[model samples]
Target: MRLSKLFKNAPTTNVTGLCFDSRKVQPGNVYFCLPGMTHDGHEFIKQAVEKGAICIVHSKELKPEEMPVGAIYIRVADTVDAMNQAARIFYSKPSDKMLMYGITGTNGKSTIANVIRNIRNKKEPTGYIGTIAIEYGNVRLQPDLTTPDALFLQEKLSEMVRHGMKACALEVSSHGLAQRRVDGINFDVAIFTNLTYDHLDYHGTMKSYFEAKSLLFSERVKPTGKSILNIDDACFEKLQRISQAPVITYGIEHECDYRAINVQILPKQSKFDLVYQGKTYPVVTNLVATYNVYNLLAAIAALHETDMDLDVILEACKNLPQVDGRLEQIDMGQPFHVIVDFAHTPDGMKKMFQFGRQIAQTHKLISVFGSAGKRDVAKRKVFGELADQYCDYIILTEDDPRDEDPAVIADQIEEGIESSNHVFIEDRYEAIRQAIESANPGDCVLLLGKGDEPYIYRENGRAPYKGDNVIAKECISKYCRHINEAVDDVNEDESFIEE
Candidate 1:
């Protein structure tokens, strides 16, 4: 790649790749001196040059001495934007080559993204990038962030195009949007699940968080794109106002373009009538809960605008794959039902608890959950209150309490927990053990937060920890796994009901 492609008034030199980290700069690569939340890359320009960076793409004016004998400098107003522009050119604008489906919200993003990818994959090659992993063809990568940085994302999208993928389903996080991580994505379909209380630790307020989310609809979406929204969400109207593309609404409560009517929430699945345009189509989802109906509706609506057959999309919804750590069920032949989820926010917790209660019915619902350190502190007490209202017993345990005292975190959560039926357990493994041991026949054990995450963050760093579902299975083996017979096959029999 020529340096002139990155900038108009730059030296006509060849570059191999791009790098933001000074220590990782390779020979013939363009080093972007971007300003970040922690350290400014400008401070490490000398180190980058020493590490074999040939072209310095920086925002600051570097001294003549800083430019080494073999390197060239290209000063820009904003290095982040410059890096994104470089990625678009280098990666051949992959987002423009395929059908891009972008999902953004506080919760349900991973599930929606996965569902879309799986459905589209039935017809042609489709890629997915979200909290769990990134998959396109034979390539599967563990993601560090829900929405990865611009360079990695663009490269992956380009790879997907090379791998014969016709579509890419991506989860657009508020942090990714706020920080300009996904600046040049030409999203063909932008779907908003819902906005709730989350990431306030970074955004500081609900308004700021929503504003960050609004950027995708306003700026990134193509003018002819479709914006599928959950009209039932509180932020729907505001999102609609910001969306520059045509709006397609889906909800159970509101009168929308795609309405899920005559809904039935089952223990293992949900049945509903998808009233779209004017015709009523009977729909069955392998996933449970009412919120999932909205997810299905959003996915179906988005795919419909992509020129897919609505009937095939609806059939695919009937057999949707289980999104990892999102309401994942663990059955070790235990008497009680043990399920795990990534419901960290208050709104997510409330929904998970409601789903637990819905299935538990007369049976006891025991909640094992905790808040993270240095996060939205106000949501901690609110977590207690929601669990107190929905659970028969609550066990507060560690969920990434980095450098913060466990006792103090527990006290803050317990403030809103007026219920006298909860205990503070510092050891997460022991907390899970106690929850399983305390379960009775037909009872439900709910493990919230740290769903599929494989590490525990302490002052030392991210120590390895088995995921919530993994830990729950281990506990069930020790305390509750009485039926240990080896008789197994895939359960192809789906218990679905429709009106």
Candidate 2:
């Protein structure tokens, strides 16, 4: 546990635990001066020194006079990389203790991670770290980042190993990869969901975005890991060429190592024949949407590569419940149906609307959706165009108008809609009410955006907000009770007429 042992080439006279935040520094902790996008870690070096930091690891070159007395000063090319190395060494490289799966893509990362976690069974104590809460054994910790910093990630993995978890699935974001947040972890399996036009603001271009995502399969990852890829994706052909480990491909379009044949896409669920190694296994998933077919195959491929039996995989998937805010259905004795989903991206929105249209038998498909302000403005019009194509009625509303005018965002979306029948409501609650009140018997109301987001970001500050799934259930219960009372009154009038 000596500081010298943790830092191989650098001087480490005094060291304890490593931390990125200055406020969290302790008497013996080594504070890493990481320059973040919003704030500079170098600015807080004095505060860290005041808190009794024993060492300072920084990316910038500094004179000896700037160093605190009795504190070791080490300079690296990048502070993030230095922190990753220090954490990996400090935690004894915990990722090597168990089977670790890294899933990276623009969409479907959380859903795929959850599906794989569910299939692994609760008996083995599987953990998941992603956009949702991080689970270590029975303990759940809320996640502030899609992938936490290297120090926290290593610490969490260490805790998972200490808790005796046999497996862990993590969602690796593009930003996380670019920042070297997951630099030192050894992965047993790497998965790539489909890539699309997303996170262009940070990446600068689509090619750069994909390059950031491809880092998961780079040489820096564990050599023994296996790559599970969706071969049907256009980018997969190129990605397969660069992958360093053994590759396993899955798709419904072509003959892959694992394939889904005899597929039946249903209104409530989907049934498919999972063909692998020249044997076909029947799988019935409780999840809805055709896109889920891809998600399920990715999970199956990951498990199969680990030598999991097809029977166990099928049985586990059959009993798997729906994930929160991902195509969650709400029923409250209402004549119509309601679904809440987190389909913020253009491709995700189109897929959700298509699924809604398919299931809306003898009903009007009413969709309530809005574009996020100040992020990915290019996708706003695409979402609006898709809604117009598949929805009978469109209700445009607020979705995190962060520092931008909600009305302006709505207008941009409106510009893409060819139909003149859409209603624009800036207030999200009013939009939900308008959609619900307009629904009659044999109608389906679809709520999109802010699926499981706990807060709504605004110019002033964020306000506590419940998930759309919760709000949809409450609206359905209130409306159904009113409908029941109205039916009772109508029946009484009928009795008087009979008399």
Candidate 3:
């Protein structure tokens, strides 16, 4: 392919592919020399050339002596932006062929994207790209990032279009927006669930984090489309002011375009009256939690603007499926209840405990959770504080202690706990076992962080870790067997009789 389309007749080459890593470079491939957090791709220019990269795209201006002899050297203002443009051209700009909805926030990105996918798939072929997995008509791809890089992202969108997918719902992460991963993709709608204390380690402050999230609505989303805002969030007004598109508000407390009134959160489901445009529509969903209610409202607002029938949307909500590891229950005939969630942030942890306590009622709520290492160390103390207040028993364990000592991480988390009911267990499996073993008949066992994540990271590498759900089910099964044995022994007694 020639660079004339992107660079205005700069140069031409028989480009076979695009790559960032020097190890992946092959003959005729163009290498993007982009700066990353830890490594500078410019330093690897010689290696890329040696590995058969035909062209070098970089931001740094190098002398003739430094440039590779045979490879084409091109300097641009920003290598990331240039790479995105190149990828867009290479992939034929597939984002233009499909209707894309972007969901961004601290807590509800996955759930909201899934809800939109369910509703959209009912009408036409719909695809999804998010934390869990990427899905299209018949393809399911496990992504390395919540949002893949510009090259992979445009390639996926092109594949979706080729597969006859008319629309897609993408979870736009703060890192994705900040790193310009979604640069070339155009969004028809951008939905903000809420902003809380998350990714503070990377963004440095909540303000910066909000700015990164705002980019989705303010820049990537089309101004002619819609921007859905959660009015109840503290960041809503700021985001509304910053958004480029028309804002559609949704909330439970405030009067908005879409409101959920008379909400009832039952044990297995949630019921609410969705008030939109002076009409009341009943929305009963399998998902239970105030946060989930907001997610549903966000999904509804995004779809409603696209002229989708409110009736069809409501019907789809009636049996909305539970997102994996998002407050999912593991019931193997256990006397007590066990719920697992991917609540890593402080705000997410508080909400999970709120829901867990509601279900536990007067019974004890035991929590088994840990924070991610090497990222957001500031939230560890807050996690301890929340667990101290909400849980009767707390077991602090490792989520992903990547290169960080699990004991040190546990100590940081323990510092905020005022009560002595918490125990620091470095091994997650043992921590879960202890929490489950201590559970009473009516008590609830809550597992947070590393919900359905398949691996545990150490200094060496990541190994297949038993997921929270799997461990929870194993514990519950043992308890169920004990319960059954006790019942059988009582039945075998001569004095015992059936009614």
Clashes of each: 0, 0, 0
By lDDT, the best candidate is 1
- Give the lDDT of residue 387 in candidate 3: 90
Candidate 1's residue-wise lDDT over 1-499, tens digit each? 8888877978878889999998888888999999988999988888888888888888878777767766788888988998998999988889999999999998899889999899999888999999989999988887889999999999999999999999999999999999999997879999999988889889998899999999999998998999998999999999899899999999999799999989888767788898988999999888887778888888889898899999999888888888878989887777677889999998899999988887677778999988898777989889988988989998999999999987788889898888649999999999999999998776789999988788889879788989998989888887765643332431223233332
- Tens digits of per-residue lDDT, candidate 3, 159-230, equal 999999999999999999999999998899999998889898889988899899999988999989899999
Candidate 3: residue 326 lDDT (0-100): 88
Give candidate 3 misplaced runs (Cα > 4 Å): 484-499
Question: What value of lDDT does candidate 1 attain over all alpha carbons?
Answer: 0.87
Pairs that clash in candidate 3: none
Q: What shift in Å separates residue 287 of candidate 1 from its native position after superposition?
A: 0.6
- lDDT winner, 2 or 3: 3
State which candidate, 1 or 2, has the greater lDDT.
1
TM-score of each: 0.95, 0.93, 0.95
Off by over 4 Å in 2: 9-14, 484-499
